[model samples]
Target: MIKFAFLIALVAVAVPSPAAAQGASGFSVVNQTGLNMTNLTIRRFGTQGWKALGNAPSPGGRGSVQFSDPDCAFDIQATLEGVGTVVWNGVNLCEVKTVILNRNASGAIWVDYE
Candidate 1:
């Protein structure tokens, strides 16, 4: 019985959970750039028009935007109120659960991965 229990525990440890195995639902848009995002849009890479997400900063100054994405892959376009447009192309929504929006050292808007 002890050996069986040990085997079960080992199997459980070896297997990844549903959430871990599959992709997470609705990837999060993390804002670390300290700028309020006035607009957010997403669509397939290489597409023309974009679908608007909304006009709201993450939550706090350093919070993130959590939105639903059904596809495993997608793209993002974020517009800062006073800043310029920052675009990320061909983002794998499933694999990359969160897309970080921040400014680079040169003071230009850039995208970061986790």
Candidate 2:
């Protein structure tokens, strides 16, 4: 009986907590647009409030956001230097590790999920 109890305790110690099992809960943004990015923010999908992600990457650079919430779906918004603000809606961070921001020949902003 003592051996069984000891084995159970060892297993419990080896098992990771719920938060640790979840791993990292955020994605990195790759700035491919020629313009600098600023005022980056993220929020849960269908939510009204936005949480600032801070320190957006410059053109041809990358930035990462680490969120505490366990939700996998989120909306991202950023303002491009000398350009208007842009938003990428309903992005699933769980599936997408990298998001690339780009601009078309017509100067319209777009996003690519990777």
- Please give the distance, in angstroms, between residue 59's alpha carbon in candidate 2 and its true position after superposition: 0.6
Top TM-score prediction, candidate number: 2
Per-residue lDDT over 1-114 for candidate 1, one digit per residue giving the tens place of the 0 to 100 score: 999999999999999777655643555567766766766787766778788865545533433446654455567787765667877677776766556767654666656666
Measured against the true structure, the TM-scores of the candidates, in listed sequence, are 0.57, 0.69
What tens digits encode model 2's per-residue C-alpha lDDT throughout 1-114? Answer: 999999999999999787555633667888887887889898888998998987999989998867666676677888887777888787767656788877865777667888
User: What is the C-alpha local distance difference test score of candidate 2?
Assistant: 0.79
Model 1 regions more than 4 Å off = 1-24, 58-71
